[model samples]
Target: MRVLEMLLVTSCVLVLMVSLFRNTINRKIGTIAGIACGSLLAAQLLFEGYRWQMIPVYIVAALLVALLLFRRSKITKPLRFMILALSIVLLGVSVALSVLLPVFHLPKPSGGFSVGTETFHFIDADREETFTEQKGDKRELVVQVWYPAAASGRSGEKNTVFPKDRGLFHTYMQAYSGYLGLPAPALDYWKYSRANSSIHTDLHPAINPYPMVLLSHGMGVGRILHTSQAEHLASHGYIVFAIDHTYSTVVTAFPDKRVTGFLTEQSQDRLFEDSRAILHVWNEDITFVVDQLEKLHSGAVASKFKGMLDMDNIGMMGHSFGGAAAFEAVYSNPRIKAGVNMDGTLFITENRDAMKKPFMFMKSEEFTNINEKQAKYRKTPATDAELKELRLTREQFDNILANRELELKLMDRLSQQGQGRTIYIEGTGHYNFTDLQLYSPLIGLTGMTRSINGTRGAEIVNRYLLEFFNQHLRGTESKLLAGPTEDYPEVKYPNSVYQGE
Candidate 1:
């Protein structure tokens, strides 16, 4: 909970307790308590903002203040007791809600530049929208760009973590809750979230023509989930583009107020089988976005990106299924120099030997070691007694062994394509690759993320991103990627071969 809000809850509890004993307490004590409650309520609203979770508490505080007006009237003891019990329950509920789904902060940017962001709506006429109901519709994309910016803009204002539009933001909140597979009401406090970037801040002339990156979210996820990473890249002198792949996103709110939710027929477990066609569309989306980048400056109204972007030095990256798409971009798109995939398995398994780009996969330990799960069973077969203790049927154990063999075979086929570097973050899970890990501490508790501290995970991820992009995009190089260092012990290159240009 916010500072003023916490204080108000404490004052409300004290006032309610005093009111419950008003017959024994001085009338002046009740008056003072009511005044304090009213004053604190005003301060909370002025500084801390209102929330639906606090509505019950707000009602209780208002009732306490109103009692001061009727101080001469005698109150029944039972009624006072009821008020006390109800107030305590309401306050307790508010505290729990706020703690569970906090208005989280993005870790401060470690680079020299402050971040600035802008959103653009683009439509691809060449490709028809395949997932839509219309007879003929072009694919529409919502792209948000983050760039290095001056310390202050005219308003000196920063952007909200989600959309500023109330209707859209509320819809995003609903979609995010669904994304996490949580109940809709769980993340309602997300409406008050903040980001580290300012909107449309003036860019220094020297910062122009920075290296670029196109960011894609995980399958069925929104682009804002990658905001923290994008901001960090921008601060480090790379212009980053994050796309809300429309129907594929958890939710997308267009400028016309048309809201779209996940329309893709892909699930996490089925992605390897179901995502081939979807991958092509996302690849096209990335290509079309690059094409649109060139056209933005051609219009009569000069785009803010005019001459401020280095289109030739472009890099690509994505999390989960987005990761595979990044590999596709670097492999197929001549304009893309390098890419990284985080914790996503490949959907496009064919013709990948042609992949010679500077690329790597930053995976969670669980995902990285998946092919080796059945290794133990082969080395020292378990006895019937052990199998019974584990409660696995003979066939189930056989199936596990078979699955591991198939995964290993698939990985061997991938290895034939070429050497690929992989960085495994210890005590991490798939969501750790995106800002969703930092949504709340409860995420770690639920095993959505693992034992890694969210902020530490972000720091490690950003440092590598800065290093990789610097070596491939900018003319600089860092030893972090050349070989493993004592620094960032959480990052490992197990079975990894550092690719040199």
Candidate 2:
């Protein structure tokens, strides 16, 4: 909650408490509490902005306070209790609404530099928008770049959360709510949250020619979902470029107010099948974005990045489908010095063996093993009853195991080359890799997330990302990656720890 929001909520509670004993208390004291509650409501509206969740709070509190202040007769004990109970119920609903869609801050970057970001709309005439049949429709993309910025520098700001004009936010989030199985208004308060980023600030002189990382989102997920990780990377002295893969995200809103909804949809089988080419278009998108980044640094284009990007030492990372695509990028692009894949299935099978570079595959514990929780704690295989609850038939279970084995086989082979490693985070789910985990406190109650707190999950993921990139790109090393340690008990190395070592 914002400063004034907290005070207003506290004041409302105080008023209810005092009103419960209104008859017993001195009239002066009761009146003062009522006035304070009303005053705080005005103050919250005047200072901090109001959200829809607070409406019930505002109305109920206002009416109760008005009754206390203006109504002359208070002889009926039963009537007083009814009003108080109704007010309490309304306030409780408000509290639950607030918790379900609480405005939250990104985990503060654990680095010296501040972060700044800028968005660009680019069209590649060389590649047509394949999702469309139009003859001249080119590949359009929205790229947001986050970089280390000087605190003193002047920069324009764009809020990803809670912008004053929210038409774009509504359109974007409404498209996503369907996938989340939530009502359209469930995520309405999300607009009230904001990213901890400024726009297009001068690069921090401390890290000139900062190593760059290209970030990619999962299939049907927007780049906005990865803002937390991207911001953290930028703060720690790296340039992070995240792309909203056109036609792949839930929605993409351009500065021109033209919006495009997700256009690409295919079966999982097509993703792994070579004939389908689910990754082919995405592979080109990654390569093309890098081409544009090169142009920015070429001096031909007027850009602050002209001499401030270490384009030669680039890296790529992604979540889910994006992670799979990162493999293709690093495997195909020699300029990408390192890569990380967070909980993404391998979509590029052909190039798995031929490539060798610094890479890390960050997996969630459940993705690593379905019955890991029971197996680790109780030393038993998942029972048939557990399988029923998991909704997995024995055949499906076997197939999944087979797939996981193949994945681990590749991970182990890759870990043998360069500075590659694979580790899974315990008590985390797939969305834990993205900012979606931080959306609500009740997120864990759903199957999408597990036991890990969203903030703590973000911290752990960022810590490893910084460590991995610092060692591979910046010539630094941390013992945290020199096999697992007590420092992060949640991080578990599968099979042999640090196979490359």
User: Top TM-score: which candidate number?
Assistant: 2
In candidate 2, the residue pairs with backbone N, CA or C atoms under 3 Å apart (3 or more residues apart, or in different chains) clash, namely 162-191
Q: Please give the range of 10 consecutive residues that has the lowest summed lDDT in model 2.
A: 267-276
After TM-score superposition, what is the CA distance of residue 409 in candidate 1 from its true location, in Å? 7.7
The alpha-carbon deviation from the true structure for residue 172 of candidate 1, after best TM-score superposition, in angstroms, is 2.4
For candidate 1, the TM-score is 0.83
Q: Cα miss at 206, model 2 (Å)?
A: 4.9
lDDT of 1 by residue, 1-101 (tens): 78888888888878776667666657777778888889999998878777777777788889889986466777788877887788788888888877776
Residues 1-501, model 2: lDDT tens digits? 667766777777777677665665567876887788888888888776678888878987788678667767654678768877887788788878877768887777878888888888989989888888889999999998998887785765755543346787778668878888788787776766778888667767754588999999998878988998999989888999999889888888777989888778674333245312767888899999999999888886687788788987898999998998898889888888889999988744544765768889898977656434423423445569977996777665545445545665677777777556889999899889989888886877777778898888988999999998988888897788888888789999887422221
| Deviation in Å, model 2, residue 300 alpha carbon | 2.1
How does candidate 2 fare on TM-score? 0.89
Kindly report which residue stretches of model 1 are placed more than 4 angstroms away from their true locations once superposed.
Answer: 13-24, 55-93, 152-157, 267-273, 297-301, 374-419, 482-487, 496-501
Model 2 stretches astray by more than 4 angstroms: 24-32, 162-164, 268-271, 274-276, 370-404, 496-501
